[model samples]
Target: MNLYAIVLLVIVLTLLTVSLARLGKVKTKADYLVAGRSLPAFVLIFTLLSSWIGSGSLLGGAENAYKHGFAALWQGGGGWAGLLLIYFIAPRARKFAQFTIPDLLEARYNQTARLLGVIAILFTYTAVVSYQFVGGGDILHLIFPTVITADLGKYIIAAFVIVFTAIAGMASVAYMDVAIGLLATFTMLIALPILAHHAGGWSAIRTALPASHFQVLGDFSFVQALELFLPTCLLLLGNQSMYQKFFSAKSEKDATRAVVGWIIGTVILETVIVAIAVVGSVLFPTGEVHERPREILAYVGLHGFNGSAALQLLGALLMGAIFAKIISTANNWLFSPATNLVNDIYIRYISPEASNKKILAISRLMVVLLGVWALYQSQHIDSVLKKSLYAYTIYSAALTPVILAAFFWKRVTAAAAVTSIAAGTVITIFWDTPFIHHNVPAVVSDRDAIFPALIASVLSLAIVSLFTTPPTPSQLKPFSEA
Candidate 1:
């Protein structure tokens, strides 16, 4: 397939996404933030699936599969664990009826806690958005070398993301996701199998690849696996984006059912992507695809299937699906943080007396600011998976436990909550500092921000609660009774 044609197809699809977003009426704070809290089961399921699977899985997961084989499944598996955890908590989160994760924390803790939590969410979520932009730009650069030329491609890609996201908030993001999620799933499941069969069979794939590539555990030792395991599990426990899906659902049953579907969808789709990468490694066998493992889907689509017309169509669909996944994820990550800025930070602090109209206006403005910030940061980052881990760690380590305690533990005081959150967040930032990362030995130094953050949060919660006074009977009544 010609690169020019592919670039044109992407541009057209992007325009269609923008057009659909404009059709929705984004008048209220609820509409802009959570689709008016009226999404049915199907929409909620796809939105959750699409938002979670984004550039990280399509590009970064494939990259990991190429480099480390089946071990990459651990990263995808983390979300499955998180969804199960969410199943038990979704009803409560939905009952809270709040706009942001910080809102729940503030209700149980204090304003200071909310402020700190917002700062952490914004920093990390913005970084996640930036890396998605980088991944999309890489795709554009690969397909249309002239349009996304060496000097200007980054700017072009960033500009498109900013414009699309700034158009209509979650109103736009949700619908786009539904369309893309279907495409992405079909692309991987249908296309990859045909490509595999054409390249010979499962037998051919096994014989062609290194023996180690087939091992489920890959090269990771027990300790190294734990390093990957803990952070992912912690992040899953309280992911803000997942909560956003809960808030958007039409009802409790819809939210719960959607998440169940999400688990099944993630397991199947992620496994297929990994399988595609393994097949690519076997057939290519020269590491020629290493520089852009994310493009393996495209490479297989364009070259691997020889002369079959049906196979070619499947390949195109798969390629299109990967592109859809990138855009949908980018849209959600870019939009959700803006909701936090408006509902939790801006409306709370900047103008507490502001009307809903003014709040919605401010939300749109912040979306532009955040979109530009994401674009600027996109230039320096390289890997979607790494950026995602950093973002997830910041939220999971610092905020998840604190939020959990808010609903489940009546003894949790504002001071204890604040201390735990602050300590966890500070340690996470310190662990990621250049000096700290460089000085630590490779065996001990993996970028598991959740480690220090979760430890500090837990210790701070325990020690502070033990030393300080617990909430009074009146103060504890609401949570205790509920």
Candidate 2:
């Protein structure tokens, strides 16, 4: 193969080997699920960063910037807003340590709430993982067009991520994130100035694209921006993966410290990513990138690095890092639902007395099964932006409301939580369905699922809780005291 492809392939192999080496350490259920609750601030920082900045930001958000420019920050801006809230909640999350989000739901509400929590996570996380396959496949096609087509690349991506994640569990996922986090940070920071220079500076970018590209709203309406912001914000606020990572933290301080670092890194890197896409807009233009704009960053990488440019090697490194980011995301998202399957369903309901070895075996099996399922979904929903938003809305609308109530409101009753979840989940599923969508008032039907679903969820929580009895003191103790 080409030297660039070879070099990047080597980097991928190295990361995989490092992850595989961590296998010996994953001996218990805690080790597999939460890294034995041993992650420190530094490790937590990178893992959170790497996990958050995935195909959605790299491919989908970049595509938005490719067309809309800086205004696309609304997508990542939502997470940034959510991160501020996460900083306050991190310590409490650590104090309330658990293996999965359903565990928290069951504790705060009831068994039905827990089962619904698991169902919401399965649907949302699998959708999240699907797009990662699409992104990785796009990058692979760029590197090895002759040998591995994009469709083929997707299958390979799913297989590798499945096995790699199954091998070492959270320990490898957390620590391997260290390398990915550093590489992505350095690559994006370095690539921007150089790519801007290559694109003939900021003035050139301004002249090449629409003026709206520079505006806060960019040609999008306020509602459109809100559509992007709400899902990401809600997802971050209720993200099981983040809480899981917090549970993995060695202490509350470590978890809290990590959030500060994660927020700073997210803001900078997301801005830099959009900047890269905007600059790529200047180089590749509308007709080219628009056809598959999500590949803008990959196109920029291939062009910037493969030739006689001064930053050629660094460009390839950045490209490799981007690819690694995709794989890392796939690993993270795919691993999450598997955790839910094993912890919430398998162990909790199927085999509570199952031994550690038996549990770990089933955990790996779940990873493979979920990865395959995600891959299947990716094949059907090829549009990354649509899939990403759809997935984000499901989790944001369904889980975030009840999850926040668990910590913030003792008046939230079990019946209220259960009803809220069912409302949110059902609304999100049928918001775009042809039969239901066709019959609704255009005002409600025309909007994205976030508004309708979130409104229904919140209203159900408030009104239903008013009618039902409040949560008992014991349920409020862990949340209030911690």
lDDT of 1 by residue, 151-215 (tens): 26556656666667777767677777777788788767776777677669988877876666778
Candidate 1 Cα outliers beyond 4 Å, as residue runs: 1-24, 437-443, 472-482
Please provide, for model 2 over 365-459, each residue's C-alpha lDDT reduced to its tens digit, 9 standing for 90 to 100. Answer: 99999888998998897579888999999999999999999988889999999999999999998888887667998887888899989999999
The candidate that wins on lDDT is 2
- The alpha-carbon lDDT assigned to residue 203 of candidate 2 equals 92
Clashes of each: 0, 0
TM-score of each: 0.92, 0.98
Model 1: lDDT to the true structure: 0.74
**Alpha carbon deviation, residue 288, candidate 2 (Å):** 4.1
